[model samples]
Target chain A: MKRRQFIRTAGATVAGIAAAPYILPSGSLFAATGNRRVGHVVFCMFAGGVRNIETVHMNDGNLLPNLITGAGGISPDILGGMTALPAAAAQSLQTFGTVFKEFRYAQGPTGHFNGHTTAITGQYTQVDLNLRERPEKPTVFELYRKHNNPATSALNAWWVSNGLGPYPSLNYSNYPGYGIGFGANMIAANSLVNADAYSVIGNTKNFTDPQLAKAAALRDFLDQQFKTLTPDSARLNTASDETRLKLFINSLYTKAFSGQFNDPLQTGPGVMNGDLYNIAFAEEVITEFKPELLVVNLQGVDVCHSNFTEYCDNIRKSDYAVRHLWDKIQATPGMANDTVLIVAPEHGRNYDPNTLIDSYGRRAFDHTGDASSREIFCLIAGPSSVVKQNQLISTNMGESIDIVPTIAWLLGFDSAIPSGLLPGSPLTAAFN
Target chain B: MYIHKLNIVIITLVIILGMLVSACKKKETTYYYEVPDAAVTGSSVIKPNQKSTLEYVSILYADLMGQSIPQPELTRMVTAYEAFGDDRIIEDLIIRNLLNRQDADIPTTPEMRANPTQFVDAMYQRFLVRKPNDYERMYWVQQIQQDTSLHPDILYYAVLTSAEYRHY
Candidate 1:
């Protein structure tokens, strides 16, 4: 009788474990990453404003062959045309997870800054959203940093952008209780570490670890005295962490000046742009830190405002970059088979073209907050055991603002964040 | 008449002798003591406003070169420093770069090692624009005495990246 009862209990527990997601709400199923399926995430903003027509809709030819499938044939005017020479992924990205084909950025001005802010903060900001100011809402970085167990380091979360501009400020926010202490490590990959940057900091003296430690211990003593007046910004990295970061940067300076700093992922000249460069840096960050959360922003497609042909080519380039990043992520030790990569545009471009015509005679497009500009697509690919495989959500089930909470929920830190901070719910339908 | 005059002169001379005798006595003097400035600085209260990026680079350049940096160099410095999230590491790198330059107005390591007291005092005045108080001076001197690898370049790097230096 004891054995029969034990078997019955075991069977009941298995059934309950399998059925808990349906019984409970999406976010309610798990409150922490240990119990959740996936913890690592890579949120890539296919930025600079892309339209669905060229991407998910494929009204032209299929520009993102590695990411989006079913729509075949390459666009004739696409720069250098499409080639399968380099396999983007083991398979189409949609095969690995779900694709939200008809997502929307429901609110806020359809500008790059506003879109990025909304996506990162999970709130709909207005026209007052300045390009240079920190987001009024707490960023996902803050939410992750402040709530994650074992008190994660700044290295565990990275924000890689094509350019600094307003991107540097997005790592943390001006929101009270969640500031620089909970910010991500930010790198403007395209501009921060070029040959010019190497020229500025190339020949810094290299101190040994023991020497640096002695200096750092002394610095710590000084910091203890100045802690009261040193702003939060000044203490973003701990004395030891700052020392480590300095050493890492010194290494980068050496590598950059030595001419070994170029990204190997940029296979061809046509694919060489800021987007891939930024992704290459993201790959480096992932390799180095194996961060739990890393957000990458690509802006090459913003060239669409002036040249439509270049815009199409840039979309393909971004696709290639994101594909290479995933490939790199899977190749990484701690992140392999564990990291979930989410790709979505901050917002979409307008449907109609303006007067500017490119050399290809194609008219240029602008994202002027039109109805079509509100539409976007979010593709989430992860392990088959974790993410819904080959699932397609075409009923406009999600919005752009949902990305923050969605990320938090996947990382299992959503419950720790105050509900009021994230106005959007996790797109649970895309997960198992 | 002659006798009366001689008697008056004698009396006057005696009185004058008495006055001289009274004027020949000794006198005393007084002295007071003073205290030196405290060991730690008053930097905590003085620098209230944060320096703008422009001010920071310009001042950093001037402090390193003993002359104001060119506007173009200053602009590049500001741009390079502002192009990241954490200014601490970047500023630390910039400090090292500036100090590594041949034109940097800093004492040599051997010169500093020869006289740690003067090195600490000069550093306090040079980078922090104040005197290293008694404890600061003593602690730094002892540090330089103990740690053979602690060079003036590293000390300059430390002070340049310190919170007190970032202000004002």
Candidate 2:
């Protein structure tokens, strides 16, 4: 039977029990206290400081009748690719039922690392740029795994990155009592592609002799590197649970390398090479794993620093990628009616263009020190479909950090969980 | 009946011969560039100014790139170290990996069947770049040895995945 059909049947059977309202214990602030509304949550980081001018506000100021204007609402354009708007509209276009059009990262540092860090932890602290350091607090991934899968061993969550940087270390945090054990599985998709040749070497731990098999050769090589490398001090879990995750990761690498799943690079829509490829991998994960909490980071829009023309081009492509990802999720056997997709840029770009010009003779842009860098938008859709169509919540000044609490709430964590761990609140308007 | 029995015998012989032939065919050889190790004399002593820095850099490079370090890249790193008197190549490569599109491959080790302390010590040397403190060694040894089912390879993997592996 299809996973969605089984979920529907099971949901129907448990509707009555799930509907009963019950208050959480006042003392247990970190534990989950509510019924799950959605079985899966896809949090797209939408990184690299997307600008409003070329994105949501592309219809305004320039005086052009952009496709966003044709869509009948000024706000829906922020969704970029969720709508039925043409990808080549005078501007990028996407449709969704609800948009926090005037959403703002009212708190936190506006740098790339800070924006993404806040997106995960929901606090706007000034973090060091140490590649080895994780957020000092409990991240949403940790809380979700701890509360939702306390006793289970299923791979419940993952964080996939378009590129490798400090981002891979964000899977968990340095919070006491909550660290690697509660971390999400992270995959740098670009790196996975490069390592394709090595994943088939088999599990090195299983081999007993150095000359017996390829596994031994791999083991010998790894041993040499291990002995000579200066270790990063970050702690990781090596318990039986972690071992399970490692095995699972190996399986994913093997599958990805085998080309059993679709690779955007091989079948791209004629454009979008970097971040779009990551989005395709994210889609594949949703279809294959159906992880309960999945976060994907895409940063191709950062190219705006030196190539505005390509940046604009990428913005349009990003719109299409989002739509494609959503469509894939909808078509997946288990995720169609069981997932909630939340999309938001980490932060926005500077208001004015930089002096640099691309080969296309277009003005380049940067996000360094502009107040407009704080401008951002968000869209939430699906599963409950509780949100009214074309709904706009412009009055609420939201922080990037609020996404974590909102995600926690959507996944059935107690209200206290967010209140205790985050400095922001849920996007309450999207819920029933 | 006698012809049927002969047919069955012949079929079984064919299957056994095919298995033997396939098994005896030349085994496919796997190639890997061996990373040189820094010799540690005592349980806690490490050779200073050892080649461990380059090895560490390669792993970090692989971690970010998601593949083994290409020979040219490795040569460039070694050359940079010779010229600069430091392994700053690691930092430069890390930044390059983050800024560009690439992949990586982390090497794997054999499981520790016994001698949990020795295995844990090896991990501390491999990933932590030092010997485990007395307390850490004792604790890990106790943890793994008592739980014989615990795989030592898991511990090594855990360290590789740690925050320590990422930062200076």
Candidate 3:
């Protein structure tokens, strides 16, 4: 061969040799040794266009007191200057783990759905108004389900959405090699378990155990026959898991009717909203399943679009709910001391207030994808042994796309998924 | 002369009976019956695309209620149904809820047990929009025949939530 031809051939041979192993082995990209720091992770997309002025900024820092640390960025007097909050079980989350106060969403239109897509898929997305469409890339749930050691099922991956819209579709994607079957089990907690739903499905027939068994058996037979013709008829959960879910749903209905769910959140000051109810129900899920990967988004703060005062109030309530979630996780038997809770707003709100002003003379804001809107914060809190304690980073250290890879790394299977798929790496500073 | 008279009487009675038999046979009409023609092709192939949430709820309502659901009710059911992530569990609960309603247009257990094939064929046409293949017909028919605990409500629930029925 001529010299030029020899160089081209050698390059192709070497590239092929390097790629052959990852393509052949379905295990790990770098053959990782499976050792995990934490067994459970709860990713909270603390969304609804949170602005830094209300949060990390010490002047107006009462909004997220549970998260902001009184270290280098703010003086202790700022926290002391704020009105006292209701006493809670745990201390500041930042004291328990690391906080990146100036984290950036990096690239993407600051739409709520786009922010969610970035956080869940770990990839920046272009503006797409179709909130109902699945992400173009595999979700962290799919990657974990497909690549984790000692393969797990759908129940282990749970997503609890505050309301509706695109929240339901975030559990899975239309990406090839991953779809509904490998998707996470999700529930729009507020929408699925509420007074409205109770009014309708509350008194549904309670099938006898034997009758349910017969129906399940018959369904399996029909499903098997149908699967022969249509391969994709298979669903995410298995038969037994499906039964468990059915019973769980039934129990929710029972609770709704049995007077067990009598205004769990207080009315005045307690701020009964979908976001609070969402985390409340997610606590129920954690109690039941103790899922390995749980993603629950709270967006009550999005009211900033119209009511600034309510938004601030919601911020306070949202902080309380988040802290409550952390406390509940600590109290749960299996998840206590073993779970990592990662909370971050999907994106920030516009710096400039909108035309409307609330009764408190504060103007409402919108997430217009401006500079302020692109700035957000992230808190990675867990047991101090696994996560760094009382550490705070005020500068921009990580991007929104880093969450998936961070989750993969914490779960100890980062090398299993193709690194090229996730441009972001684990936020190592948060961990030891 | 007397024996000849008796033989004539017997031959006359035989001719009268033959005429009566032929007339009775002509009065009866011969006809054939088959299953109602399916809106879709009568084959084993299923619809290519799955039904949307609205479509599934509408068709399921129509199939069970034997009438179109009201617009408000359709929206309500869809909202509640879409709330749950697992379609299987939600579908089961809804199916059971609908089956318990007084308006649920399912065949009575006696009606189903009386003629298994007719009930199975009606269900296939109602939900799947096609006839059940031989194996399906045989299996379900046998199941209905042998299984004393089989309830027509569950039979309807099974076929309604079947993978094939999820499509057009």
Candidate 4:
């Protein structure tokens, strides 16, 4: 080969080798060691906040009448999935998971953005309620992906947020050390379902000659415009990683459009529930990609800010989605055997009811001012061997930030590095 | 058998050449961030002409569709691009949806089929906000002419989904 050609080929080969690890599947990239007990971890952020009264510790049928008694109870799992302290007479304590009913947002700003970020990053940031900025610290996804060194092509981590607002930046952190590239594959579930994005993006087979020409002509036009800007300015992935991710997403979108994977909201009363759609899609992702870590953000229950009846209804739906989502995950072929699921609301609701009432004349509860917002709970469940089912760890006294370290401990990724001055530690007491 | 022999020869050659290249460059690194240095503090690297995210999204939307993208959809588009690493797929879907709208007055099938070059030219004007150069016009016209299966819709989709349409 000519000298110039040889240099070019060698450089390309080196770049390929460097990028190869990130462009491969996680299974082929990292061997499961004895220390790695958890094969997969799913973190479900029951966002928009939930109150302790409505969850974990509902007083008979007083707080949420519908969940406990009204019209023969909407969700059996809501009652079935928790252990009431002292065992309430009307409610049973039998559950499929361990619930930390005494948990609180002991640290961090007490709201959706801060709580969720703290839950994922194991650190607190003073970032305002504005959703403009990503987390300052590395998230559990970035930590797992970076520490484990999964191939970029492997769908190692995903964040399926139910809404688009204040959530656009949470898929990854903006930390200088761990930013853009290492972030999770985020899907704004609401955008996907509500916009019927699947129908438009997934219908690739119908690309007629005319359509291709339009696309090409647009490309040609755009190319000239791009010339005025500085070249190579965009933060682009390695060509291989880009190609693989695009193809994988394209195939998944196709499968979604084909109705191969059933969306719960696609039919019946579930269609009215956005949280259910998010859960169904989360389940689809878990089954399809089998990501090492998956974060599901469901915020429909936040309707309590205005409409109490809708809020209660949404909580019931969210509860059902949670139970159904877990069932689906456990039933999925690869995920069934070994997956750790953590479900927790970002924070809780207000102590006092607001004056404004919904169409049902039921009073609403806001979460911003009251200390009740700090009151939240977490449920951790996985294989019987890993965690004792139906166990309650109320005495552990954990914060939302502890979730990241706990996940790290479970997956045997990186522990909370105290030397680095990170805020939270693993919920080691939750483990057997 | 001959192809296999050629592959083996190429592999060996690549390995030798790669080793030579690596020795010359002691460290190969890709930095995701630029750390500030106190030691070399004076003038800052500035590119004032760089396009803001809003400018990039708005200009493209207005130029292509002759109307502002609804604020909500625009916000979602920006979010999709910023949160997710690549927004090419989202852009394509958005453009298709926008053009397919009833009021978009986008070319009908017959209009696109009758004057293929004219369609391409209009696409350039709408999407790029400039007329297509002779070379671009000729190249696409020739491709469409040569391949009867090549449709005008494909050109529309192409221009709508191009990197230029996405970025400023």
Candidate 5:
């Protein structure tokens, strides 16, 4: 059967078995024998204006002295001033060292749509909605799913959000799996609710056939509700809005068809109000599904539009979350030696010598200015077997175009698939 | 009458002698004169005082023409003229004139031309008193052989340094 039809039938089977307990013995048998080589990639994307000088290149005496270490050394001097990590957690960060050793920023326009698209695709498309117009060029995630074959598993690829919009759904070909629509804050809330829901249904941890069926039914209901609420007119507003809505719809549709939302709600700490909530959701997803490839786009550092003073604080929070995700990945069972973690900002903020406020009050400036606005960081940390360990690789001429190719390379696929469109060199040094 | 006749004969003889002597004086002695090497070769045709002007022109040609000019011909033409020893100054002045006359209509050669080298050699020989060295001679001949422009200005420096205008 085709992948989509198989997913649909599997979902129906899980649901049908749930209503009747006759298939419980067979479900248990299948769960015991299922063996898959799972790989997970966590992307800590600081969507909006995170300045290089403040977060990554903090050498001068700035606000967060502890987080802003001078050149050459790894540890920050003033550990107490950083608000992101707790005292003990901050101490551990000093040992983790700089993750941005091989990272480099790109020069381009500073529009949100342009920067985000460049960050993912490695090519700057003038039209934001051009992906839909031209679907031949595949996204890194889409390519990964195609290579891995998502038909045999319960979970394939998960896009858990922290701050950014729902993952770009235009890149999704007819993939059988769902992309969870819950934003970082929303996902944490849903996980908490789902955890409670799972408990009340008397299915804790072990996802039975019956539980899968019920989750699929709920997913189908939610998909119908979302489609009813979001009319064709509402869905087709702008390119970005349409892209986001499609992702929401696709996630609901995939979940309903796959019966993979068996453990929908699993809640954690009340850190959902700030950047910590994003970290919590990422940690929750990593622990729950153990998905082969997971992309978590953290967006709170873009809080520059709201208040300029808290920009540094927001970046610190993002850094704290990055450290948290790395810690979890290392601690996880299968992810330790196989997984790769990447961190980078979607775009940088403007540079201000005096009060840290640009014209847009969010470091908004020309796209291809100096190092201040154009410069960003990219950090990759994983097992020595999968990625080079404890080495500072040169990134002199690297651009945003390299990200997609680098991801494809790490996944052991020829990234030259989008040859003409991307035209970016893979970060070869990052991997062994 | 005898006395008068005798006086007349003496006077006539004296007059005749004076006229013969004057005639002899008037017939200037033909001296076997040797031509100076400077005059023959036109090397020293330009006096030391006039060396600067030629030198200036040579400099102007070199700079304006760039490395594409045959170096041997330039060196030979500049060295042959006394005024061109200080080629830089003379060259500057010539360049200034050329710049001023840039918009003026340049005369065109109607006939099919020889190579640049052959033209340069022919022009050099036509203007100079003595022929240049085999290398210098061949240099302009080759240039003219390549590009046909019978106009002397095409080989202006070579023509200027030649022996043809030395007397003038």
Candidate 6:
């Protein structure tokens, strides 16, 4: 009669039913190989901090004038200067109107490292030292990799960025040797390193007759090498290391086939619009793998620290990248039916006029002060008509702890996994 | 015995079905306040008790500028009062002046250094507009001299709450 007893009995029944293959068609077997009950998620983490007044709650037109109809003190020329983009790019911004309607601001500890960790883990801790020394917590990526069906060749989750310090220290993530520095290096490496013959076979999608033969041959060679090179004494270590290596190799081929493997050429200099790169990369991955879940943290907005003049401009660019990702997913096959995109900032900037001036005369206010500085937007968009359109969720009472459990709920995971680390409730307004 | 076994199996199945149904049903107990549309509406009404202390000081400077008070008289009054009260009021005015200027540098001339009465009078004219009640003015003057450890924020809040600061 109790909930646990009920779940155990139901789970046993479902397990018995699921073990039988006679109930499924031959084509359904392929669906079973991939995650049949899985839901795909593309998360856009607006790294660094975005001012709440400027992006989400900009009722006044001081920061972004274009967002307002009749402005107050801001000049028209300055507003136009901030948004001088092509018409097609400008139109893409509207797809996010529904997303912005469901926006919820997240609050947490104010530093860059702490904010980033909280954004992924949905747990707040004062991690002042290096991120590697921080306590372990399960990220959304870790959860998916642990529970999702593993017959697929590619990685179930990836952490890619142009330059965002170190990846969150979660045990289950597949860190694809890509950082801000490595992103540039990878781009350059692509141009210099010739494609290997083995890589060429992996890049093609000709899975019929001859290609099938080639796949079998490659699998056989690897199996024989795996046997001779790795003894049974070190099987566990060798297997894990080999699995990681295969994942890396498969990711490279996935990139090559998608045509994004060629080093992304920087147009001028500096950090080459990481927001734009993340958008392009997510699009390529969705098209190739149609992954059950993906997380991409865009870092160009943090360039505000370098020069305040670029802050608004970077925000607009990041907004456009998010819109583009959503639009592509809506158009992609199979994904159009059941994918959801959640976009949010890791933290926010201080609005106090005192600390607004930096060494370069740039506005660098305190981000750890009152509630305003801690406010940053969270947006969710999906095919499921769950949330009411154009609805706003007040985040004053919410904390950074709600995100992971909310994500798990949306993915239909059993809530029995007590999210003790996250003490807040899910944003039920986001669901039907 | 056979009938008992059947009853147990049926009970287990019923319980399992109940769990699935309950779990699938959305949680209805959570409550959220729908964000009001009026929060984002634009208006031009001047809010009461919202002018910061720094803004009040700027009003004082504007009044002095309007009346063409000599720099020496203004500096003397401000400096003499600076020693009697919290230093942040005088400090805030100096900082505001530097920020508003194109060169972004504070004035350091002797004429600007020795004027306090003229500075106070000018600020009273600009910020108070009409005039402060005799009792209110006396209270402020007495408090400034007596309260040497007041924080800038508290001073600003006090100024904002004043009737003269509210109307102007």
Each model's fraction of native contacts: 0.45, 0.00, 0.50, 0.28, 0.00, 0.00
Predicted candidate 4 versus true structure: per-residue lDDT over B1-168, tens digit per residue: 999999999999999999998899968688798765424323322233534667766765675466876787576666555434345445545556555555554676577668878887887777655666665677777766766665545666666555555543
| Candidate 2: CAPRI quality band | incorrect
Counting clashing residue pairs in each candidate, in order, gives 2, 22, 1, 28, 44, 17
Each model's TM-score for chain A is 0.87, 0.74, 0.86, 0.75, 0.59, 0.64
Error of 5 at B43 (Å): 99
Candidate 1 vs candidate 4: the DockQ winner is 1
Per-residue CA lDDT of model 5 for A1-432, tens digit only, reads 999999999999988877665432222212222122225566656666566666555542333223323333222433333343342243333233324532445655665556665665566545543332322345455555433322222233555544223233323323222121111112321322232222211111222444334433433432332222222211112334322422332343355346444322222232233455556555665776565666666666565654544555556556656666777888889787667777777776666543345433443223334566666666666665556555443355456778766665665544324246457876766655
Q: Which candidate has the top score in TM-score?
A: 1
TM-score of chain B of each: 0.69, 0.38, 0.70, 0.54, 0.29, 0.27
Least lDDT summed over 10 consecutive residues: which range in candidate 2 chain A? A60-69
Most lDDT-accurate candidate: 3
DockQ of each: 0.24, 0.02, 0.27, 0.14, 0.00, 0.00
Give the TM-score of each candidate: 0.83, 0.60, 0.82, 0.67, 0.45, 0.49
For residues A1-432, what per-residue lDDT tens digits would candidate 2 score against the true structure?
899999999998797476443322222424455777777788887788887666656542221122123333333323342223243334222234456767777666678888888898888768756775788988888877666623233256778777655777778888986777677767665555434322222222342333123322333433434332454332233345344544444565577667654445334334546777778777766755678889988788888898765566566556656666777878888787777788888888888888997765667777764668888878777754644444656665667878988888778874446345577888878766
Q: Write the per-residue lDDT of candidate 5 for residues B2-69, one digit (tens) a residue.
A: 99999999999999999988988766688998864441232222322232434444444443343233
* Rank order (by TM-score, best first): 1, 3, 4, 2, 6, 5
Fnat score for model 5: 0.00
Could you tell me which 10 consecutive residues in candidate 1 chain A have the lowest summed lDDT?
Answer: A23-32
By lDDT: ranked, best first: 3, 1, 4, 2, 6, 5
Q: Interface RMSD of every candidate?
A: 2.9, 13.5, 2.7, 6.5, 47.7, 37.0
Q: List the global CA lDDT of all models.
A: 0.80, 0.61, 0.81, 0.65, 0.46, 0.47
Better of 1 and 4 by lDDT: 1
Instruction: For candidate 4, write residues A1-432 as lDDT tens digits.
Output: 999999999999998798777553333333433166678888888788888777767532333221222223333433432222211224221244567877887655667888788887888767777756777788777777656633333266788877766676776777765665667777765565433454334334345545555555556654644443454443324445544555555665666567644645333432446777778778767766788889998888787888766676666666656666666787887788588888888888888888987665567888773678888878777777776667776563788878887887788755323247456676766566
Predictions ranked by DockQ, top down?
3, 1, 4, 2, 6, 5
Off by over 4 Å in 1: A1-34, A77-90, A127-129, A213-234, A261-263, B1-46, B113-118, B138-150
